[model samples]
Target: MDDKMHELEIRIQKLTQVHATDRVRQLISLLIKDIGEKTDASTIRIPCPLTTTDLARMAGTSRETVSHVLQKYKASGKLMIESKIITITDPAFFMR
Candidate 1:
């Protein structure tokens, strides 16, 4: 019984991680479809009005994780964030 409980715990942890990833993916898709404008075939610009906390709620993830992901996108030059605006320099990056 103890072993079974441990196995179940591990499975739950894995599933939680997967859920978080899925949430982020959903957030990205929503951002793209809801606000993204095509500047060209490969680039999109989004005027994001939502705050990090708002995004977190929308994504069903922690605010820190959302901030971290946004920073990563900024670092990779795939996106830019300024105040309440977000520009997606590489739409292909999110499609993948």
Candidate 2:
């Protein structure tokens, strides 16, 4: 029952973030929650058993849009994608 309630709370939070935030932030938040795991205090690792199409479907956006936002993050040094894995260097950027 507690697990179910926690899952429901997460679903509500996701809905709130989706409706309240911009596309980029929405995608970022989803990526962190769905694909990422915190390896330490400040770093989040998203291992690549996932694809942009999956992310687009989850984010209710296009594959092209997902790619674009990912590229922007890559360029900004906030995210790193290599060897089919993604690492978020600054998790706090998305927390805001």
Clashing pairs in 2: none
| Candidate 2 off by > 4 Å | 1-21, 30-35, 39-41
Q: State model 1's lDDT.
A: 0.72
Candidate 2 per-residue lDDT over residues 4-95, each given as its tens digit:
89986875566556542255565666668777898888889977655777766766677787788888888988878776577888887876
Model 2: what TM-score? 0.67
Clashes of each: 0, 0
Q: Lowest-lDDT window of 10 residues in candidate 1?
A: 11-20
Predicted candidate 1 versus true structure: per-residue lDDT over 43-70, tens digit per residue = 7777657777887886678989888888
